[model samples]
Target chain A: MDSTNGSQTLEAQAKAFFDSAPPLQNTHQITQKLDHFIQHSSANGEARRIVCVTSGGTTAPLEQRCVRYVDNFSSGHRGATSTEYFLKAGYAVIFLYRRGSFQPFCRSLPDDPLVECFEPIDELNIQVREAYSEAVKRAIVDHHAAVAGGLLLKLPFNTVFEYLQMLQLIATSMRCLGPCAMFYLAAAVSDFYVPWKDMVEHKIQSGSHILDVQLVQVPKMLSILRKDWAPLAFCVSFKLETDSNILLNKAAAALEKYKMHAVVANELTTRKEHVVFVTSGDNIIVQRDKSHSGNDLENPLIELLSERHAAYIKDSNRQV
Target chain B: MDSTNGSQTLEAQAKAFFDSAPPLQNTHQITQKLDHFIQHSSANGEARRIVCVTSGGTTAPLEQRCVRYVDNFSSGHRGATSTEYFLKAGYAVIFLYRRGSFQPFCRSLPDDPLVECFEPIDELNIQVREAYSEAVKRAIVDHHAAVAGGLLLKLPFNTVFEYLQMLQLIATSMRCLGPCAMFYLAAAVSDFYVPWKDMVEHKIQSGSHILDVQLVQVPKMLSILRKDWAPLAFCVSFKLETDSNILLNKAAAALEKYKMHAVVANELTTRKEHVVFVTSGDNIIVQRDKSHSGNDLENPLIELLSERHAAYIKDSNRQV
Candidate 1:
């Protein structure tokens, strides 16, 4: 199919999916919380720059009862760490993450962190180990401060249906912010999914027969997101590939086709150590600095993105 | 294919898989730890039972580089909680679990637990909140005690390859324990998988086309495990079905075919509320106590399983 036809089909599929899906259980509550957070943060002419950081991975359930699912590989470390940096950079963050993925400020801790860091001082008292006290204190204090100041709002989803709907709600809620709003689409979303209507509602029986699953192309929502949902927001998307030869080309194509402000291109092997930013004009390579042992690539990447966002805001104001 | 041919084919495929896959990083250390735990526990006539509790779900990677995978639905809560009860019953547990799954004694805590349960007393101090302190302390104390005494050994795996390979290693290592060893297979193991030889080595590219994935039936290793690996050990497996019609029948078939000592049958919806234990003699229905508001089904379930294990040990001793 031609690009236009493909895009049209994807958009149609998206509409169909939305129409068929039951509304998320916490839609009203999430809306209320978002409205309260945004209103409170923007009050008194101290409107903080807002960034919606999508993290982790979206799952496509093969069975309606969901005994099995297809999942992308993501720890949500990038988005979680980015949120911390964003908070440090004086921006309000809307963290939309996969359920049970990494949480912001808890990245440095162990997987079962509570079981190790805590201790029974007496019957009613538990103290953090001296070794972990400082780090734990910093994380808790920063997290509590961010929540108390209405600078961070966390929303979690498991399935693809929940993610798309939640994304739409977040975008619409942040539409009033216009140029001050940004989208860091770092989540590793599934590209194909079985439609709910076609799925079986029970555990698939296993015996001698080979199991064959047919997955329809998941509708690309980037175009709709940029064009309709939050047109004036600064948006960035990610393109992860194993082949370096086609990574840049595919990223460029995505940038033009979806009208993304910038697309981050990364290879599977070197994703942790390096990434390339594909903008309209320039291709910038961002690498982890060996000199600073503890610093991550997100620190520099976020700095560059935030600088560009500031310039975009200034330019938009000048146009107005 | 006939059953004989199918079993032969599966064994061949398993052999091929083991040959092709790279060796796990910490095999030597894990084997050493298991040997030490088992030998020490069995020494001085204070022979505590050993149980290798496989918990959580295993993922089947579609790609060789594995950007995407098929995952079974499991949080590893069953395995983790069972480990605690097993420890309480004086059985040393080898917790082979999925990475990032629930840990024993930490089940009652919230998802984003550390952030909420902790308070920064000052710049360098952190303390568990009063409400959560008691629970947190109990968990920490129990976990530490188990670890310090060498009664618990945790081994984490992500993919099906890792889980199966690790299970084989553990089973072989525990063969010396004879009737004193038990296997509690609570993990939601995937039934179908794309073989390593046939898997793509890169991320599957997305376009305007339907994706068809062919998954071969996973080899049923339970029979091989019973006959070859640990013949004298007591093995209990789980059957989680959505439909009530065929649940008991399937469990019975599994018990007979795999030579399993028992099979715990549960419906997906009522798994936490009730389970039926199917054995050679009779099917015993185990239910949660509604009168005792805070009681867990595990309390009774473990008690019954332990009694059976003790009887099996006694019978084996008498035979010897």
Candidate 2:
């Protein structure tokens, strides 16, 4: 197909996906929050850099009432850790995370921190346990500062429908920032979904020995975000594969096809240790500092991305 | 087929299912914990009543590496609330739960209590906020008491494979308790699963426009639990359906087929407000006490079940 026809086909598919989706439960509230956060962050000619860091896994509901769902694999570690780094680097972060996934500044705490890290001092008071006092204090102080200072905005999503719609809203809202906006697409979005209209209202009965489910492909929204929503925004997408052999190739393909500033490629097993930055010029391999016991891969990865974003911003200004 | 032939077929299927499944990661640790807890709870000829309460929803992994999986809908509220009542009724609880699901004594706390309910007092200290001090203190004290007093043994699982395997271990370990042992199967278990041997090792590639997944029935383990694992243990299974029309019939059928002491019939909509206890003799409808706003359906349901269990114990002693 010609380029024009391809773009049109993709546009139609994206439109259909959004048109048929069940409307988000809190679209108005979310949009208002985004607008307020964006305006506050960019207030008084500050021109502060803001990045929307998408995190965790999106679900594909099998039924309209959703007795069952297909979930992508993500603990949201990357996004959470990266959000911390971005905040530390003096950037406002809009954390679009899956509900109940990891949170920024809470990585050092236990999974059930409330139950595990605290004890009742008396009938009316509770105190953090001695062993966890330092970690808990740090997490609370840092998290409070971020949220209170209007430097962080956390939005949660569960289903693919909610994720896509929210992402579009965020991208469009951030478009006003021009090249200062960044899209850190790290969420493990579902590749396929059962359309809302076609889904069964009731839970699928288990009487049948063999169950057959047909899941249609979720529309690719990256092209739309690049071409329409926020063309000047610095975008980075991720490629996670169990097989190392095909990881970089797929990432490179994505970078070219979606016009992403860079594609982060990492094998599933080694993702925590290292990642390859697939860009137009050359592939840059970033790794966690082995000598530093507390170092995370996201630390170095975010640093590199921020540098690239800065360079891109400079180039965009030069063109203007 | 005749009863004997049917039993044989079921046995074979169950065996095949277990044989083909991947081994649990921490079987030895789980078994050791169960043994210690059971022995401690039954120490000094106390003959304490012990109930294995399975909570939350089990996942059915579509791939061996599990980048994506099918998940059942369950907040684990029923199981968690029932556990609190069982503890209050002087029963040791073996909480076999899905990881990250609701926990006993934690129902009243906010979802992210660590962040929401606490504030940093200094660099090395944290205190529960005044608004949440009472709730936090109660939860911490109660949870600590139950865990430290050897009344609650919490074991967590993720997939159906882990849930079933751990359940078998718990049951066989509890077999010596005879009538003192009980099984409260409240988890939303997956009815279908992709066999481990047939699952792809890597994450399923999403290049295809349409993905076709064929899931086979997960073998019914309730019958095996009754006849083989713990013959004398009183088992109360649960039936949760979205359609209230088929709920009672299905619960009754399950009660008869599995020879459960009772089956709790609940609809998705009204589960928090009410449930029906389907037994051999009569059906009892239990509802939350509306006169008291703090009242929960599980409180009355557990009270009734405890009374019936006491009668059952008396009958068993008379027979002995």
Candidate 3:
């Protein structure tokens, strides 16, 4: 295809995607929550920095009435943990997450989190187990405080369609914050999806032992977000790779391509312990502090990003 | 292809699958747990009837390194609920569930499950919220009793490969239980998978704008379970359909083809409220009692199945 034709076709495809896609089920409710939260956070003349942390993996359904889907690998651990850090750093957080992935604060609980962490002391009462009581209490109290103060808003998504649509709504809603708004996208988004019009409405029967599935590229929306949907917002995206050799290079390329403020490059195996921050001109490696056992890489990572975000906001204000 | 050739090829494929598939990571540990639990349960010349409740959905990885996967839709509510009922009915349960799906006692917890159900009373204490204390206590006490008494063996699986291998191990381990053992196949298993030999290694790069994926049918193992793995055990499979018209017919066909003792057929939308149990001689419709708001369909379903299992054991003894 010629360049002009390809560009027009891509633009048309993107438009069709948004037009034909099913509207998010809780759009009205989420819009109300976002409006109220933004107003509340900005009210005191000391506008709280607002950050949207997108977590977990988005699924690309194989059928309209989907029984099967292709999912990216993410437990949402990085996002959830980063959210906690962001909140602790005094930023208002919009936690856009997968419906059933890990949640902040409950990460330290047992595998059978809710049930195993509590015990019946008697017929009249249940109490948190002694071993888990301290951690559980701290998490609950801090989380409660954040929610009550209108500093945290939780929005959940399952499919790639829902995630993308909700993200657009979130971005536009935060536009009023300008450079004070931040997008920390750690969610493993699908790069390709089967269009709704092309998908079958029923469950694919097992009668055919072989199945052929065709998926078209999901139009890259990063450029659009940067150019249109909350253009002045500070954005940080992630690049996860299995190979360490290509990790930093790919992340740097993404930084240049998307004009991202920063890109966090992580290898699959060492992601929990280390990450390389790729900015316009520098690559800085950050590691979990071995001297302190409980210190997470996200603690340092968020601290650095928040500082950079603050500077970005100051610079933008001066420019304006 | 001739029928004979097709059958032979199918047999060869099944054999190759088992031979080439990765071994379960915790095979030795799981085997030891099962052996010890079985011995303890049968210690006093009275053997506890064992039920293996497989919960949640198994995911089929699209690549060898598996950054992406095809996932079956299941929250494991059926399996988790059924496990509790089986436990209450005085049966030992092997809860082989997906890693992150619902657990037996945590079902009643709020959407953000653990963190929402408790509050920090003080610096030193955490208490379950008054509104949820009673239910929480009951769940905890019952779960604790099951684990402490060696009546529950919880094993977790994630990928399709891991799930099948673990299921095989569980079935073979339960062979000694003979007619007293039961298989409750509640897990939503994927019908098709990209075989490991054919799958690409590492993440499927996003460079390919359009992606084509080919998946081969997972060899049906229900027949193998019936014929070899646990010949005398009673088995019940599930058929979850979105269409009401085909649900019962598909369930019945599964029962006949797999030589399953029963098949539970459910429609997606009404699954929480209703299920039809298809057996050799009856199609019994079971519904949640609307009058009793808290009554789960599993309570009656388990009662019926356990009674049938008891009869089967008696008949087996008579035959022996």
TM-score of chain A of 3: 0.95
Query: Order of all candidates by DockQ, from best down to worst?
Result: 1, 2, 3
Best by lDDT, which number? 2
Kindly give the stretch of ten consecutive residues in candidate 2 chain B with the minimal lDDT sum.
Answer: B1-10
TM-scores for chain B, listed for all candidates: 0.95, 0.97, 0.95
The collision pairs in model 3 are none
lDDT of 1 by residue, A1-320 (tens): 23666666767878987876657888899999988888877884855699999999999998888889999998898899999999888899999999888888888877777867776575445667878776677778878778777889999999888999999999999998989999999999888888888888888888654888888877788888998899999999999999899999999999999899999999988987989989998999998887977788888889999999999999998999
Model 2 spans with C-alpha error above 4 angstroms? A1-5, A121-125, B1-5, B122-125
B237-279: candidate 2 lDDT, tens digit per residue? 9999899999999999999989999999999999999999999
TM-score against truth, every candidate: 0.97, 0.97, 0.96
Query: Which is the leading candidate under TM-score?
Result: 2
Per-residue accuracy of model 3 over B10-65 as CA lDDT, tens digit each: 56767877776766787798889988888887675787899999999999998777
Go through the candidates in order and give each one's DockQ.
0.64, 0.59, 0.58
Pairs with steric clashes in candidate 2: none
The digit string of per-residue lDDT tens for model 3 on A206-261 reads 88768889998887677667877879999999999887878888898889777899
What is candidate 3's TM-score against the reference? 0.96
Q: Which should have the higher lDDT, number 1 or number 3?
A: 1
